[model samples]
Target: MEFGEKIKELRTTNQMTQEKFALRLNVTRQAVSNWENNRNLPDLEMLILISTIFHISLDELILGGSTVNNMTEKLIKDGSETRRAKFNMITTLIGALFLFLGAAFFFIKAHSVEYIDSSGILHENFYLLPTGFFFIFIGIIIFLTTGITFVNSYIKSRR
Candidate 1:
């Protein structure tokens, strides 16, 4: 039997569905489906884990038909992509929050704003514009830097 068929048979014989099996494998159901369909192969580490879980040898898991070496690169790429997406989402949320607060400050002013003078004297002044612009600049910088890093990592991973 083919590798895909073997996986399917093992899964069925164990009475484990794709989702349950994926939970054991720490991967998504789609990934397991792809593996069983022969559309993809797990990495060496995963293959070892699967063999251990099934109480089978690596030879049987791969049918001794050249394991590990032929596994697709997509699994590694998938993990990287998931992490990148999470990082991008967090940064985007924080950046947007900063920008929103900055813009809000431009329209909302404190009734009595106090600040310390250069000479250390206390003074009452509306420093909202400067503070608002400072936040805006920070937000812009965050966007630029994160954007650049995201692009760079994506490019590197493609290779």
Candidate 2:
């Protein structure tokens, strides 16, 4: 049985209502409902309280049935992996965006020309080159760091 099912079973077996259980746990009735419905999980303290109140071992309360421990471990691991993947994707995208901006600035700087004003004075507007190079350097750093991190995480997950 799932954790939620186990909670519900214990509550019902002890002739306790959801409101009563929530009151004992110092939480809202909705919290109890959520737990029973598996919409959310209780934190460690609450889990301990549950086990204590129900007069059951923590292992029994959490495990509920065979393989539950394994399943929970797998779930946690998967969630972490998913978060890592998302981070990698976001970093890669931001790095690419920085690189594009840098390249665009560099292009503009290179194509810029010096022109004479109405006063017949020569003027140069080549300041963008330095800024472009700076951006390029920053972008490359971000790209390399994130890429390496992503590769490392991917390899780690494979094991």
Candidate 3:
């Protein structure tokens, strides 16, 4: 039940060729082969990406009763928890900021007056409403992703 074993099992279960799966994962075929053979472990981001692409939980990928799992959990509990917490906090703040900006734009559009000139075109400075909302949506996505990562890591560490 090591990471490599899990990868191989899932890959085979899905009936994906190494090349096809690697392409789907946006990695090299050799990387997939290496993973299946247990020659190397995927890095943090890769592990996350793989877990997401396969619809598998991160815990299922990283915690398979191997020494690496123990080390990874210890690293998270001892060293990386604070960083992850800080990251989640920062993404939340960013999301809030974007949301406020979007709201502000919406308020301006609702409350402001528009004037049309000789060309018969009206102008409103409230165009930023949609722009701000877009940023807010992106920020929220980041925030949620960071939060998910933090919670998953925390739970994995505890286990």
Worst 10 contiguous positions by lDDT, candidate 3: 66-75
For each of the candidates, give the backbone clash count.
Answer: 0, 0, 0
Estimate candidate 2's RMSD in Å: 7.9
TM-score of each: 0.51, 0.54, 0.46
Candidate 1 residue-wise lDDT, 1-159, digit = tens: 566777788899999999999999999999999988978777779889989988999776765354442333344566678898998999988888889888888867554567897999887546787988988998998899889998998798689
Q: What local lDDT score does residue 74 receive in model 1, on the 0 to 100 scale?
A: 49
Q: Which of candidates 1 and 3 reaches a greater lDDT? A: 1
Best by lDDT: 2
Off by over 4 Å in 2: 1-68, 118-122
Looking at candidate 1, the ten consecutive residues that score lowest on lDDT are 64-73
Candidate 2 clashing pairs, residues 3+ apart or interchain = none
Q: Candidate 3's residue-wise lDDT over 1-159, tens digit each?
A: 566688888888888999998998899999999978877766678878888878887776777554565426544664566776777788788877877777777777778888898899987775677786787787778778877887887798689
| Residue pairs that clash (backbone atoms under 3 angstroms), model 1 | none
- lDDT tens readout by residue for model 2, 1-159: 887889999999999999999999999999999988888888778888999999999878877767655326645776797898888788888888888988999788778887999999988766777777888888899889988887787798699
Give the residue spans of candidate 3 off by over 4 A: 1-77
- Runs of candidate 1 with Cα error greater than 4 angstroms are 1-38, 41-76, 110-125
